[model samples]
Target chain A: MSEFLGLYPYWVVIFLMMTGFYIVISRGNLIKKVIGLNIFQSSVFLLYISIGKVSGATAPITAEGFEVYGNPLPSVLILTAIVVGVATTSVALALVVRIREAYNTIEEDEIKDEIRTQGAGP
Target chain B: MTPSTDLLTALILTLLVGTAVAVVRMRGLFPALMLMGIFSLLGASWMLVLDAPDVAFTEAAVGAGVSTILGLTALALTARRAKTSSRKPWPALVIVTITGAALVYGMSDAPGVGDPAAPASKYPVPSYVERTDHDIHIPNVVTAVLASYRGFDTLGETVVIFTAGIAVLALIGGVAVSVRNTGPAGGRAGDGQGGDQPDELARGVEPAA
Candidate 1:
């Protein structure tokens, strides 16, 4: 029972990951895909945070009488990662905007259909 | 404290899972974005419970705050409701199931959650704390580690953010100016991001002149 309960965090992370993965592949909407990618990245962040937990510890700060602190390294790395994820999201959204300008639709299928009907020519 | 933290983590994780599922299942792109923000907030709560307050703060701000704003701005430009694509779900489901199962199975040998004795918390562990104290003297070890021990890494992250900003500005700055101000494709002009019902995929700001 401890086994099941203990790693529930990991299970949640995996579930979130798969949900995002499914959305990315199954959904043809480009915006949905970006959101899926967002979920996937956030799950990775959770995984890193989960791995850093120390029993009975406080946040990774040196506080009086607090002997243990969560690992600082993962938190730091994830901080950078979170920022990078934002950057990626913005760039992706910008690209999506550009795509809308190119093709009248953001639906992947419609965009493909537009390409097929339009033909791959200048 | 351990019990309460465990309960809190479990509760938040459950909510996070629900929100993520809702995000994908939600056909309305805007609500899905909000759900994604909720997911980030829930993740932040879990992070706080797990004792990574710095990461929690970043997640709450960057994940929930900035990401949502960006998603909103993007939604403003794109269709609101996601069209039901013709793609078969069975294959994706099978792939995701296999991958998830494999990861969970692989995790069996890994240390249990919050296991302080785990290799991750053990390695050069005290070194960071000790050095941050001696060299940096900052109470917030995360800040010290990020700005000092991992100075180059943070610098790289800044470069990445700067490049992304430039790319976005280059790509979108003109778009804001050039996109024909067609003004509200369908739904009520007051309703942004699908606050009302819609049968057709939102025809957002068309760039066609």
Candidate 2:
């Protein structure tokens, strides 16, 4: 079990990704769907951090007293990803707000109905 | 040497199977989303075990962070519940099964896990370790791979971000204006519901009037 605990992170991330993907693809409520997306993205972060871990190494800094250092590359990549993630989230939220204003309902089918109605005469 | 290794292996196996089943079985979008987060967390740990921190981090951020958020955003504009259609999702299942089987079969030709003499360590890694002092000062191989080997690709990604930002500004008519209390014509109905929705959302789910 202990050994399994160590690898628990990897499988967890994969599970989260798949689950989140399913939610995003299948869900009806817009906000709930976003929550699922967040979960999926967070799993990737876990995967990255797990990769960076070293058995007995220290932080990746090379300060004067530093001897052993774990990997720093993962952290760097994650930082970039975080920035991009935040940007994408804000943009998505903005779109959602626009969608609400245009359709008055967040439901996908409802919006589709509205569009269809608009497309048809009167 | 210890039974702990066996236990760890079992636990991981169980989690892998459980996560897959849960993801497959989940009908609602919310719970499924949460489960996805769990899956990513597991995948991150798996990367760690493989001693591929850089890859793990990328997966965590891009896969779990950005992808999840983007997906949820799209979902937010749609519906919350899932409806199972009469059409079976058989094609996707078949593809996934075949790919998985093929990957497992291909693993037979790969080096054993943690093998010191693996080509990965022996070939490019050793050269990087030796020549890094002269070529690039960065000690991290992943950094070298990204900033040096794939520098052009990184630049292209930056340009994509810039383009997306500009596109949003132009299409959405610039920054969001403050929601006014005034109604559509000059009065109450629009003032009550119109301003309130955006405000409530901004306030983090306070009930809208």
Candidate 3:
């Protein structure tokens, strides 16, 4: 039970990561794939934050009589990661829109089929 | 970790896992997007439980808020339902299982949650936490470390976001312009001899003239 308590968070992280990976690989919809990627990234953020935690620490605010503080480095790093994740999501969605406009379908297989047919000509 | 905090984290993790599975199983794109928002919100809550309020704040704002709106906008521009995949998922399942096993194996070596002696807390982090009072004097060590020590990385991250925004604007903006140009002009031209020309180009049936 103690060991389980110690490592359960990491197990959750792994579960989330694999779920996202499965979605990214199995889904045909471009948007669904993007959503999967977002889940995967968020899980990574959770992993980092989990590592930075200190049991008795509150927020990383330096105050009188407070000895333990969670590591601020991971939080700071993850702030940048969160912004990057947003930017990447927006860019990916924009590309999906453009793909839909060009091919009229966002299905991965259909897009591939269309490309093959177009390349082979009438 | 205290029993209460541990229980809370476990509950949130269970919800997060359930949401992720639901997201993968759902067929409708809109509902999946909503689930994705809920997933982010739950993730933010978990972060809060882990004592990283700053991370929780950003995750709530950016992950749940901005990403969901962007997803809705993209869905409006695309199909509502994901085409059912015909391919066998066994290969993906095998791969995911292997990856999960490897990660689990790796986790055995990782330090427990909030372990003070963990390598992550050893070197520069302690220095940052110790000196924040004397050097930066900011109450929030996160803000001080982010703004003072890692300012360059944050600046680069901002520039990357700016560039991505510009790229999205260029792509989506160009599509909107082409759409508008083709709509009215193609309608007008369709009434004339050149009607077939713009209509064909607008539909991407032919190369633009």
Best by lDDT: 3
Task: Report, for every candidate in turn, its global Cα lDDT versus the true structure.
Answer: 0.84, 0.53, 0.87
**Model 2 segments beyond 4 Å from truth?**
A1-122, B1-10, B163-209
Q: Which one is best on TM-score?
A: 1
Candidate 2: Cα lDDT at B66: 62
Instruction: Kindly report which residue stretches of model 3 are placed more than 4 angstroms away from their true locations once superposed.
Output: A1-5, A120-122, B179-209
lDDT of 2 by residue, B14-90 (tens): 67558756765666655665665666656655554545566566656665566566555444433444554343455
In candidate 1, which residue pairs clash?
Answer: none
lDDT of model 1 at position A102: 77
Model 1, A1-122: lDDT tens per residue? 68776687788898999999999989999999999999999999999988988887878778779888778888988999999999999999999988887786789998888788889622
Per-candidate total of colliding backbone pairs: 0, 53, 0
Q: Candidate 1 DockQ category?
A: high
Q: List the residue pairs that clash in candidate 3.
A: none
Ranked by TM-score from best down, the candidates are: 1, 3, 2
lDDT of 3 at B115: 87
For every candidate in turn, the CA RMSD to the true structure comes to 4.9, 7.2, 5.0
Local lDDT at B149 for model 3: 82
Q: What's the TM-score of every candidate structure?
A: 0.90, 0.55, 0.89
